[model samples]
Target: MNIQKMKELIDKLSQASRAYYDEDKPIMSDKQYDALYDELAALENSTGIIMAGSPTQKVQGSVSEAFEKVRHSEPMLSAQKTKDVNEVVSFAGGREVNVSWKLDGLTLVLIYDGGTLQKALTRGNGEFGEDVTANARMISNIPLTIPYKERVELRGECLISWKAFDEVNTDGEYSAARNLAAGSIRQLDPMVTKSRKLSFIPFKLISPARTTKSEDLKWLASLGFDVVENINAASNLKEVIKQFAPEKYDYPVDGVIIEYNDNQYARSLGTTGHHPNSIIALKWADETYETQLTGIELNPTRTGMVSLKAVFKGVDAGGAILTKATLHNVDYMKNLQLGVGDTITVYRANMVIPAIDDNLTRSDTYELPKTCPCCGEPLEIRLAETAHFLWCTNKECPAKQVRKFSYFVSRPAMNILGLSDKILEKFLSLGLIKDFSDIYELSMHKDQIVSLDGFGEKSYLKLIDAIEKSKDVEFSHFITSMAIPNVGTSSAKTIAAHFSTYEDFRNAAVNDDFDFTELTDFGGTVADNIYNWFADKKNVEEFDKVKSHVNIIYPEKKQTNANFEGKTVVVTGKLVNFTRDGITKELENMGAKVSGSVSKKTSFLIVGADAGSKLKKAEELGIPVISEEAFKNMI
Candidate 1:
């Protein structure tokens, strides 16, 4: 290995990582990329000049600015992907090519150094990633400590279950499961992340080495971790795709991965600018069908928007399987020439979301609905920037109320126990809950609640107790329960902390004298929303009713300028002294601002065990890095 060549390769790889991470486009294939990375790693190991933030020692960087930076014991590299089967066959030569599902979820790298869960990270730019150890701990399937207890780092996708997705989408407007899973993992509240029921399926071993992919799955399974064990070894590319077709699986997988089973052979093959030359992914070929629409169904959603669902006869295009299609909005309908009795071609667009590919046949007699199906109210076609939808006239629709109420009592808000959609629906049907405020008056329906199906004497009492206990919620929780647009629980907490009480917030919003600019991160949009929410008399009346029944609690204001008052602290990694959340709360209470990452302005980096990259960065920049225990002592 030439030292000069290694330096050149490292510099090129760094440039490539920057291009991919910052630009969202790859400069080279995964195999070519991984080969260069391996070359650099081997060179560095032989001649010890590994950079502090080199790709050879850290996980890849992610896109979002929300998460904390974590240093990986072993850096995550991009996987090789290939659409052609000939490529897979070529890689295998005469040997068998293994086919498996390619999950489209956030890639999580979990490192267990010294028999404890050390760090968790997202693949950002194939060099540095966002630290998400706290969020990973909340995911049940990710083991806190593996049984082997040996130093090891594993890679997997953090995903939300389909059942949980439907449950969370009671309001019928949550984004795709992958989006929600990614969003939930980065949430500030551990409780909020926990309620998401995220699961991890360890797919690859990052460290402690590996020989075969089967052996890697076995190793993960030994630790009681779920591993995707769907492997089909085939002699050729056609056989690989046929065996691992999308139709064969119950769940969704983007493509099939084919990698060399032998670790030595894989290492010999090596990496490129963005992928491994040794591994190849066979993306499934999408099938399309041409069919005629029988009728259009106007489904009224919880938000009072009437969706245009096309009921079409089965159509087949190539090998793609799609029966029902989404019109999305009235604009999509008009653009696609979709109406009752119109002939259309359907295909799995990008082999994912089912879409109307084209209109093959047109019918002049097709008609559009003028009124909503549910309430028989006149529907209004409203346009935002890009699209238009039919909105129902009735504002107090039952579906809307139920959706709003469910969100109000969600884990982010009051977190009342035993409050589900079924129970809420039953209560609503009985004219018990008309708004979110109606939930506070449920004590009056004790006898009626106990009599409902699935509710017995013991259960009913517990539910009432849960509601009663929620009355003493902090001002932040109280604000979240209102379900104001764009104001999530974390934002509500930031606002509540600045205001100190609900009255202060109300006065600021209603009186218009308070300067919202004083609050850090508070923008005009948020302030306008606060003002608008209080401006509505109905909202005020509802809030008053809720306030009357539930006693909102406030924490004692912290004494200003305590120890570490003037000093800026950047908290990183898993804290042994306190939960990362606990330490953050204490630090904020003591008048210190807890920042997400390090800067030249950062006074100190309060680090915990397994305090990866940020600690290294702090050291390189000459910033003081202290342990959690030491931080407690200082306080």
Candidate 2:
């Protein structure tokens, strides 16, 4: 442990960080990176010689400042971190570590002048950030008014809702939730930001300077602000991260953060220029290995495209051995130069799914199957605008039918409770269901379902009741359940609202006049997909079957006063008196349009307790704003 060695180790770690953040590629494995970082620390400790520009001292300047720089009242210190549990134990000298979810989101500093939110800034370059006060107000989770209107500043992560992300991103191209959240926060237009369904969950009270650690989470929760809960208190980092790493997650997370909870202890520990000595981020060590591909299996999709499924020699993924990884399509296989008997580096990308990172051997070559795996029909290679895909000409593939049925029972579609994959498969095998529409006819076989292994008379009757209830669905759900290509819930709603009736929609499809331009969210790609879906005779037949069995419930009309006729109402956040949809429906019923975003023409921006960004925009636009309670009374 010498000065020279320390300098070399620091240089290596710094280079690694730069490579990861700048290039989106890691030069060293997580374990190797940590070992280097630890060696640097050990050298510094033994020699008492801290390098002038050590990686341990200063936070790497990565994100460029997008606004004016402001020196924090208390310098926003970066957390001290260790991915290894035993290393954290060594670092802490066996002290307790409080572990929590390191939410992948935009960090915001909220300043309260007197009792009002004065300004909110993003963690841009750790010094400066764009003033996003107007946009921040529209987020549903942040409280507009707090118990302590007394000057206090808070630090938290602003995130996107799981459901909201799916709704806004009609195109399923967003790779990570954090990326989508960052894009939403950086949107130039307030309306665009408002529509994204961003929410804030405060983790720290940065200012109004408390002497103690504050245990502020409970207090914030009481004030109706969303707070991230600490899951485990462990003596080591390993136990803590294991506690946090559940089987599945809706949002993507990179690491777990562990910090000293005692305020005085944290203060006494002090901080380096980069991260606090009291806090540290622990990243999971992804296990990777070279595996040989056994063969490529093509699974035909409902879109008539055969997706390449790669069967690799069993590789451990998140503690489980997995043998198959989806190649996505024929182009994916070709792009990666994948072949049977070729060794490929397989690892869980973000600890979610097994992905072939790179091919290690190309001594032997394999070709895409000429025949469809399911139907044994000759495969046709189509040169799509983006890439080549193996097309399965057979439209009635069982795999495709199963997928359609799965979507129909999914939450976004008909939401038929208790109709899972097992039941659907059973019904399909029994010849009770062969298509998505066949679900509507399930009630006819209630007696037969009761006799099935897992089901008794009571369970079968309950499932039948749920299916029968799902028959009378909202217009949006009904349209979504149709399994129209690219017609997701949001797009479906737009189409439903535009057409007003199922008959009108069908007629428009028949006449080739289903113009989607007028709809708020519909794009050319979605419109074209819709047209293609309806044009198929088989799809039309399936639609007819479901249409005959189910009842579509349009927006119920209320007695209109025309008092707020043509006036735009922007509703923000969870209403205590009503749900978001309920408020929108009531407003629309009253001859006012319930818009997704705040605009200059918006007459009223109805806000709830934690109304975040919309209220900020209303203030900026000099538009009048009302609370949910006030809105209820007013209406």
Give RMSD (Å) of candidate 2 vs. truth: 10.8
Worst 10 residues of 1 by lDDT: 22-31
What TM-score does structure 2 among the candidates reach?
0.53
Segments of candidate 1 deviating more than 4 angstroms: 1-62, 71-80, 232-250, 292-323, 326-343, 348-353, 358-395, 402-635
- Residue 198's lDDT in candidate 1: 74
lDDT of 1 by residue, 1-635 (tens): 48668767877777655534433333432333555877777778887776655676554545556776655564456665455667667767875545567765677888887777988888765566778887788786676775575788888888776666766655654335565676677666554566566777777887676677777776666565667645646565565466655544433466777777776787798676557766776665445576877877766667787666677887555544556766655655664565567777666643655666667666545567676655566788886433466788888666566677777788768878788877886788789988777888888888988888788999988888888888777788888888775566566877887776677777777888876656644556556677788888788788878888877777668765466676667888887658876887788777887765454556789987788767866785678888777877777
Per-candidate TM equals 0.50, 0.53
lDDT of 2 by residue, 428-466 (tens): 778888776666676787778878999998898888788
Candidate 1's TM-score reads 0.50
For model 1, how big is the CA root-mean-square deviation?
A: 15.4
Off by over 4 Å in 2: 1-77, 94-97, 160-172, 190-199, 209-214, 231-242, 248-251, 293-311, 314-342, 349-552, 557-635
